[model samples]
Target chain A: MAVRDWEAVIGLEVHAHLKTRTKMFCRCELEYGAPENTRTCPVCLAHPGALPVPNERAIEQTIKLGLALDCGIAARAIFARKNYFYPDLPKGYQISQYEAPLAGRGRFRLPRPDGDREIGIVRAHLEEDAAKTVHAGGATGRSVGADYSLVDFNRGGTPLVEIVTEPDLRSAEEAVWFLRLLRQTIVELGISDAEMEKGTLRADVNVSVRRRGEEGYRPRWEIKNMNSFTFVGRAIEAAIRQQVAAHEAGEPVEQSTYDYDADTDRLTVHRSKEEADDYRYFPEPDLVPVEPPAELVERLRAELPERPADRIRRIEPAVGFDAAVELVTTGRDRLYDRLVAAGAEARVAANAVMNEVAAAGIDPEAVDAGELAKVLGARERLPRDVYLEAVARSADPGFAAAPFLEQEAVSDASALEPVVEAVLAANPEQVQTYLGGKEGVLGYLVGQVMRETRGKADPRVVNRLLREKLRA
Target chain B: MAIDREQLLHVAHLARLELRDEEVERLGAQLNDILAAVSKVSELDLSEVPPTSHPLDVVNVFGADVPHESLPLEEALANAPEREGSAFRVPPAGS
Candidate 1:
């Protein structure tokens, strides 16, 4: 059976840690590289007789993200206890939303090769992160071989918003594109850093493959704790191939959890279906149900920033599709917009930003929009090399392009005549070829003139002058 | 709606409790009685009444996002059953 004969259905659950001053329930400061257990508190450590109080700022941030995603915010949402036993979870049960999530039924659009496609978002709910468990004396430093483990409670109570998507994705490329847009949105809203390397943003992907016209979904296998987007794409492709092979061999694809080994490009079963724990969920008795006020919701909605898709649509006409995508995906569209507002030509500004600023490794925020506009506005007068050089130097503070601006290329026919005459005399063979109906050799004479003047002579004027001189 | 001995043992296992045969049989009956008592509320036709997860009528009870002083190292590790250098030592963790 060929690969295209089967359809792969993929869904993702992205967990982004909220950027707040303190932990979700406790007042312990949220520090990334702090010493182990330095941020622990009685509530976060799950000491007996300690109760949790909700953090208002975390709730507001979650609602802000939900609004940005166009999700329906739940007026009355309650946290439930997800019961399990793990060394990382000091409390036997984690406070999460099982039935009443904070937001639901949203749709996010991804720019696909075949236009844009909307991916359904099942829910985006708030939950507390678990502690970090470090296993030592193992080959992989994981819990596979001999050694005890140490627990770090500092990261235990950090606030996280888990965004779960419906099984609307069809290919691995689409999944990665959706994640990129989602990360951009989260970072734009100042919710989370969404840096996968720092462990703030992570995902667990569920994949299943069936025939093209299949109705319902088959039992899906979940790949857990994928930290990098590149690894996520590889894992999805590997899982689909594995499932398709199983179907071809008359073997069943069991519903289970698997861990993807990036080094080996293999999926190893972590836990079977029978071993899956029944997270006996119940409402958390300590925290009260969250009912956001109507006025608060409305205020947040009104203050929401423009969505990325809408920003792309507004700029796509001025800039081409590739430049528009580059601007929006890199989170530099705001800078581009500012340059446009400052009287810079949209198409020129887009090219300068995507080519010059990006290539110089200069931070977009560090570059002044007004200075960039001045440099790009003079693009027509300056040669391409000089224009690019000005764009690169615009990152320096208090630097103006006008001070170092070059004169316009020599376009006047009378001024360019001598240079054309010299080039026609030097490249006599090329001029002869041109007179013999080899019209392409005119470009060679034009290049020789521009090279003689150090790229200061306009090629268009040189072409006309050289044509008349050589014909004579 | 009857609680069997197998179900009782499963719940005990989930809660990390050991039970004998007689204890399982005895607890099964008690659980059944408690379920029966709670089942009476299900019989009421309170269709319009929204299910309440909390007894309080309040909502949005939260603290400000301000950092406060955490407990000292000694105090933070005071309640741990075992401890290592600046961390709590637990048994071998399963993946």
Candidate 2:
């Protein structure tokens, strides 16, 4: 198949569990790894004569995320009942947003190597999560080939926000980068834990392929419930290949849902018999519409923190774009900024933080920026061993640089002349090789001088002395 | 605006109801009568009024983000038709 002739249009529907203490529309406490059915109440258990009440913190958090992404907060948000049937959904329906979502029509700037691309946000709505199902007596202990399943309602009714993106991504790599940036943004906003491993963050990837200049859309396939970024990328790639191959064979691409197996690297069509597309959505009468006060919207917008894209932009010129992206997303940019404010050079401080400080397993927050800045400033003057040890212990409460700073490398030329002469006499062959125009041998002579002084002698001075003596 | 036999059967199937052939015909007519009664509101030309989901004008009803005690495990599982340990047991998904 001529894959180059086709382009893949990809989108993502990301669902993140909110960090509220209670469930979305119930009073039961949100707890993970609790005993089965221990966290359920009458409201969440769908008992008769029970009324659902929305959690205020969940709504506020969702709005804060929307404001951070530059979305328009709806004057009135409506919750609608999405009708469905399954044991996991005890209410036989999920209360999700239909026509009026809490947030709408935002754009997220995704930083790419070529340039920054804008991914359109269709909407971000609030919903409740379903229970956890543990399939038993299955071949692989999964839902496939299972004899029976058990339901744990502890996670049921958890508040979730579904953020849908427009089909703006053209490649799987772009999709992954967008997710990474999105996760960072969510986490920095303090809305959710957003841990994909813990199942707090999940995604549904939609993909379709069209000719390079095609105007209309092709039938898209939805890969459901992906938890890993790597798997999302691979699944989209696989979908593109399958659709392109169908086009090459002059067959039409059918719209359907699929399940991707990361282990086997295969996509199997999920045969859903319940008319999965027919949700029959209608307004939920049990709950009232959510109208965020204008004052509240203004307050949240004003309190929004510096976004990841803006943070990357601020630090890009100093450390370049890639390093800026790395530092900001990993949450070490604040410490780097503080160090720079404490009079440490930007590039030196960044290198020490990313390389030495990270390698020593020091929490950047634990280290006092002033102390670390001093240590970084003294790096060239101190020996290699001393400098690394200072960085490792920089997080200690009683850390001081005066003791470590005293073991400065001997840079005096006369003091290192004898050591350089002894090294040159001992290694006559190397000295001859150096004089015979093999310039690389000068490094070996410098090493001998450094070892003689036990790493206290400055390598730069030793090199200058060795080169001068070798030439004579 | 009227319900037909095939549509009635489809709705019944979606709701997991077992309807005999005679019941389908009877329910079809009854559903059409109910629709005809409800469709009378569409005749009015009150385009200025907005649609509403609830009878009351209340909006933004919420509870504080606080934890409350959940029912005991045994009491929570009291009404389950089938049980396994502390969880509710059911047939395999999509069975």
Candidate 3:
């Protein structure tokens, strides 16, 4: 697995089964865990003479993704048969796109913990999925002595959007973030559930490693069996490391499809390039070119929802406090929208949503952020006794956020500044202990005076005033 | 030149097409003719025409995320050639 005098280049082809109700090309319900092969039909099961009619919902879903990803619409898409013979494929050829994909040259921006990074989304295309097959035994599924195999059509015929990424990926962590962001975007767009654990989403990572300061990249080995984001990232790292060793040792790495062993976390050769060319592509003649009208595309584009990245950025500055905005921005936008819809100021709602509601798992719909937000934002219109109650327990968030005004005292501390100075000038006993950083005695003195002030003085102002006076 | 019979058989086997010798011999000549006929496209000034990936703009459009009913066991297993209860059994492999 050595790659000499080269750099590692990585690209990904991720297929996401849009959580749709029906198969992409048929009316068969796309419900999972149905009795195996029960959802099959002439069109879905690929019976001869059964032509695949495009699903309107599938088309619209793909278009919505294109819009969210900021990709141009493909007005005419020709479906070609990727000619391949396999036990899983009922039809000798799979209907897919080659010359014209649904959308291409798209880009997506991933939100990191600190900043946003842009990744090139090469293209998003439409294609029918093949049935599921269980290869028996070993890590290869067919590697060991096998007795038999199983087949499940429950997952078959699900419409998948194949998102191809540019080979611009550098590190494994970045790739993981990119996948997470993509999944998040799809979920936010309501386009796909994109659960990789459930096989609703899957990724194929292509990796090639080269030497440091090399001009050309090494012959990459395509890594497969990466079912999860962490797995994909780990596989890429392992592949790069393996190739780097090969390069350092002046050995060349061959182009191959390697399997990522999640248990031991290493790359094993699944099949070499010579053996991997079973995917014989040919134009599918039975399925005609899908040419949805241009006006339909226009309508979909017009109805496109604002992507999360765009929507989040616009909402951040609307709050006067940046932290409030930032905190709320991390949450589900639907919840935020509901809060705003329920007569909450975006800013106060943002704060209450982040600070108060998030900590508690109350069904947001049951207790909308608006009710608590109104109390916090409209304290002037609220009862004074309620505000006072909020001031009393300012130390405890649960106390302050008990659906009450959270403000406490600033007037008393400043008013007590002169009195505390006079007291300090007269005594000078507790001053040294306070100056020695054991300022706990200063609170005792301030509390005694504040109690004398009949709680009329602000406790915070009193504490500050007493502390300054004691300092002298 | 006559189509090479051995070369055609090799390709057919790789593609997993179980072809009779006569059918293979005929398809070999026919495919070469088709390829030779369509090779004229390369001679044309078609470099200016950018390839169209999809004619429609719908790639990511989705509906209100909701669930529907799955097929009943009997209905789901109706078409299976070999089924016990709700499962479809396949021919045993590696025998």
Candidate 4:
């Protein structure tokens, strides 16, 4: 069958690690790259008779995210034990939400190439992370050819929120856009860093292809533990091709879980449906149901920062599309808004931030917005080099651009004439060229005059003075 | 509800236990008996009552999100069956 004859149905399950100070069930420090097993406790290690105390901030952060995503907060959500055995899981089961989750039935609108399309979020539930496992004596460091493996409980019990989306995405591109917006929302709420490289935000993709206009979905194949957005897109594409080929060849596509090898760019089937684990889910008796106070939820909802889409819409007209998108997507629109509130011209501040600050690799928050506004306010008078320098220096504490602001463009004819005369005398060849109908030489002369005046002479003044001199 | 030998084996596999045939048969009967006793509660017709997952009267049981000193490296790895550096060593994992 032709590729266009089929439609791909895709859903994503994203796990975002919470940025709490401690583990979900214990006081162990929640950190990255700490000494192996150094953060473990009896509770996280699943020592006999040890009890778990849930982390309050994790719940608060989860609620904040749910409200940001417009999800309905459950009055009572139970934690259940997803029974499984893996070397990485010390408890032999993971504490997760199954029958009832913390929040459910939300919609996330992804800004698609066509338009805004809403993806239904089935649920966003809280869970604890498994430990890190390192495979030794393998070129890929995976279990396929490894001689042995080691487990580190340092990451165990880290609070995580798993968001499951409905099969609304039609292509790999849409899935990526949804993930990008979801990451932005999570980061904007200060819940998680959502860094793909750190494994803090990862996704499992479910993909299947059905004949166009078909009513029901076919059995889907799951691609597991994709760390990067690019990989997720590639895996989905590969899975779709595999499914289409199977259908075209008159073979049934097996429902299975596959691993995407980044180096080889291939999908290796890990387990089929029959081999899938039976995670006999039961309520975790150690912990009680989480019922966030109604007052707290209301407060979080009222204080929710304007979402990226709405903020971009509001600022697009003033800042233009590209700058507005950069500001919102990078979580720096707050700085832009503060600059505008501090009396900076909206368009000028937006351009200065997107062009100067962002280009210099400086965090928008590190730079003083008011000082940046002052620098941008003088954009017309200051040369591009001076403007960028001032922007970079503005990140220093107690920095003011008063001395640099003193240098204004020389627009008056009287002030610019002598500088233009000096430039003309230094380049008589350019004068002769301009007299011989090489009008472009006038630009070269004007550039010399501006350079002599240290970029303080207005180009218009220099151009007019040079033309009059050359004409004579 | 009936608990057969296959169901018992499946539960044992999920728990990562190896059960002999005779053990599976014995556990199946024992589990069926326990389920028969618990099945009486399912017959109650209290439609308005909410299902309770915990026996406690509390709703939210949480601690402040603050970090305390974690277990020392030695103590953290002390109970591991096999240790490599500071980590616990396990058999090579299979796909």
Candidate 5:
């Protein structure tokens, strides 16, 4: 069968490190780029007799995220130990949620170009991140094929929220869209920095392909530890293509783990990863189960900012879905609303804010809406450069639009007639072409008149005067 | 049910332990006895009792989101068998 005839079932496990003041179980500061191992303590270092204590803020932040996703918070949640042996895991296991995660069974309304896609949230559980390991014996910084590694425990024990989605996404594009919305929500809730470049947000993608409308699921392959969304999308697409080929060849796509070489655009199976995932899990004896009080859960739910879908839907009618998404995601919708309240047209204000102000590097938070509205109101009558300059300067402290409004174009027809006449007299060939019924030449004549008036002459006035003289 | 030789060896491997033949025989019997003793509770009808993760009755024991003084770099690396600059050096971790 053709690749298009096969549908890809995709799910994502996103691990976002919470931007807490301290580690999840220790008092060490969660500072990025800190000196290696300096942030370690007895608990995080796994020294004997050291006990683990949960950070109250990290738990509250995770609950806040679960509420934002509209998930059912667990009445009782417990931490479990996932046993493994690695240099990075100081405790020889990872403390994670197993039997009862903090939240589950929520739905995220993923906005698509066609409409919204409701992706099911399987769970969003809290866990601690592993220490960072920098392998040696490769090229100076690369880790592949290294002889040994150096471990930095500074990142160990940091609070991480693992959000898992059901295999509800069909294509790589939908998965990317879903992640964008999720990241926006996280940022809006002020929980995590969620920056991919800094290794704060990571994703493990599961991909399987079955015949379209087929009843059960096929075995899936996982692409692990992808940090960039672009690479994630590409890796999933590549995996789907491979699986489709395998299916057509009558070969089983063995479930395994893969690493995507983004530069080469290839997926290679990890030979060392055994098929068996035997991380024997049991409840952590050191910590007790969490039962969030009814009052606190309600309070966090009430404190959530407007969901991204709601914001996009509310602004979609006036500006359009694309513009509305841009406005909402970049948080320029607040300025857009204020501009509308200040009497500027909705679409025009959106375009100006997304384009002109953004291109000028103006922070939307720093811009005064009323002053920008005045400049936008006079845009048609003002010279193009002056209007853009006014918008750029609107973010300045105590900015006023009156000075910029004084530079309105020379719009009087009589005042622009002499310049328009000279422009036509100077270019007889173009004028003859206009008389010969080439109407497009009219724009050239207006350009000449505007040039003569140093761009102060309104093109509309120049166009009218040029038409009258040409007819005469 | 008691764990056989293969199951005991599998558990040892999962814990990253390499067992000698004699130790395996010895530990297998010891493990079976331990499992038997623990499973004796299953004979009782305790379905009404809830499973407890910790012996303490407390829940929601949390520390504030505050930072304290971390160990000095020298002190942190003092117990390391191997060190590279300020980091703990170890063997290359395979996938």
Candidate 6:
């Protein structure tokens, strides 16, 4: 097939949960993965006469996030009722930012470990989440074609921040980088737990393939529910193929929504019944406009943490960390602070966190991270034995590390010599293997020595002793 | 000029509107009146006024890109009208 000259112009609409205690317009808890619908209330459920009041925390966090994104704060913002209905929406109309969003055009700077590529932000607005619905009598038994689907209002009332990006992404990798950096920006801003799989972070991908250098833009399809970056990459690739295929088939690429099928790994059409419309947005009429003080916006700006891109430059030197910048970029600032707080040697701690804790690819915030502050601030109060114990239990925590360290204390570094020598004597045959150039044989000898010493002797001593003995 | 029943119903469908026939007829007439009045904004000498998409000048409030805990796939899709695996499945276009 003759490959047509096409470029996939991608934009994103990412909805993230604000790390607030309440929902966007109600008092319901802003939690996820709780018992379905447990985080709902009459106001969030949209019962009649329930006048929605904006959650202040969500607003403030939204402001802080806007500041971090470098968005020019709106002189005034407002909440409007987006009149729409779905099984998940308890309210016939969702209270959202139609005319006056909490924030406006902001720029997110994503430091491509590869280079200095700053992604542009179109806008980041705060809004309320919709209720959730489960279908029956469908594919996967979720919507199995029953008379009705199950509805959960747990997320319905949650405070959400919707970030729409300009179509500046030239490649899927850039798009993914932008999304990752956006999450890092928000996390550092303390705005939200940007988890894509948890719906705290969700992406609606707008992909339009044009002739590589063509202008005016082609009709694009919006891909929804891409939960993982890996899947996002696949979905983009699939969409590109579909677009090229459609164009080759002489089909007019229609403007519509499509979904990435993880099963088939293909892009399928969603709604083609209507083209994108002028939302006819106007100043909302119900609630008062959210006129945040211009001074407050400035205060937020003054309080802004050094940008993540800058932090990587400043702290990477101080932390002397070595790894892909992306690994540390998301949680690096907080992770570094936590290490300093834990009183662990900053470089050492940064190494473990960057490679071990964060490399697990889990959110360090989600873990019991209070230890970081404890380790940094109170490590002196904790006996050196306790410090040793903490690192020992990295893989497990049932055994108290301090007592174990105390009981297995070595009589200083030299005490390791006799144990190492004894182990060498017992494993003389293995010593021959080490001399024979099987360096792994030395590991067996080291373990034998540690076992013989009841793990009381330091392993480094054992290693030195074994090395000396084998060389002899 | 009054908006017709068919056009009203069509707009409603595009907006995912589920309105009764009589309500559609009523909305058709009301929308026409509103549009007729709002058309004056287009007639105004406002070409120099910069159009604004957002009232607030704030931008770039991003979250950490790290993946947080997600609901089990079933839980995420449990509320969908149709679902396959972790995805919410909708009925075939006509169904």
Judging by lDDT against the true structure, name the best candidate: 5
**Candidate with better DockQ, 1 vs 3:** 1
Predicted candidate 4 versus true structure: per-residue lDDT over A159-265, tens digit per residue = 99999999999998888878988898898888999999999999999999999999998989999889998999899888888889899999988887888878887
Weakest 10 consecutive residues, lDDT, candidate 1 chain A? A270-279
Model 2 residue A428 lDDT score? 89
lDDT of 3 by residue, A1-472 (tens): 4343445677888888876788877767877676566676666666668776666677777877887787877776666777666556767667777777878788887555465667788888888787876655445566234444566666667788988898877678778767776777787667788888888888899888655686776688887646888888889888888878876777878887888888988898874323335556654555555566787778877876666565656665665434433543464445556667767677656655565555554444445444444455654444455543443333233432444533323374445666666666655677777787887887767766656655545656677677565555
* Native contacts recovered, each model: 0.82, 0.81, 0.22, 0.90, 0.84, 0.00
Error of 3 at A104 (Å): 2.1
CA lDDT, every model vs. true structure: 0.86, 0.89, 0.67, 0.85, 0.90, 0.67
Give candidate 2 misplaced runs (Cα > 4 Å): A138-145, A414-472
Order candidates by DockQ, high to low.
Answer: 2, 5, 4, 1, 3, 6
Residue pairs clashing, model 5: none
Tell me the number of clashing residue pairs for each predicted model: 0, 0, 40, 0, 0, 43
Tens-place lDDT per residue, model 5, A163-270, is 999999999988888888899899889999999989999999999999998988999999989899899899998998889988999997888898888787878887
Off by over 4 Å in 6: A1-6, A31-39, A138-146, A248-251, A271-282, A315-327, A330-472, B1-95
Error of 2 at A341 (Å): 2.1
**Model 6 CA lDDT for position A411:** 41
lDDT by residue (B10-90, candidate 3, tens digit) is 677767589987898789889889878878777889889875444544343233333334455576556667654455545
Worst 10 residues of 3 chain A by lDDT: A391-400
DockQ of candidate 6 relative to the true structure: 0.07
Q: Kindly provide the TM-score of model 6 when superposed on the true structure, using C-alpha atoms.
A: 0.66
As a TM-score, model 5 comes out at 0.90
When 1 and 6 are scored with TM-score, the better candidate is 1
Candidate scoring better on TM-score of 2 and 4 = 2
What tens-digit string does per-residue lDDT give for candidate 2 at A1-472? 8889999999999999999999999989998888789999998889987889999999999999899778899999999999888788998899999899999989899876567899999999999999999988878777767899899999999999999999999999999989999998999889999999999999999999999999878999999889999999999988988899999999977889998877877777876654746678999999999999999988988888899988888888899888898888778898899999999999998888888988999899998888889888888889898999999998999888777777779999999998888888899899788788999988888888888988889888888888788667
DockQ of each: 0.67, 0.76, 0.23, 0.72, 0.74, 0.07
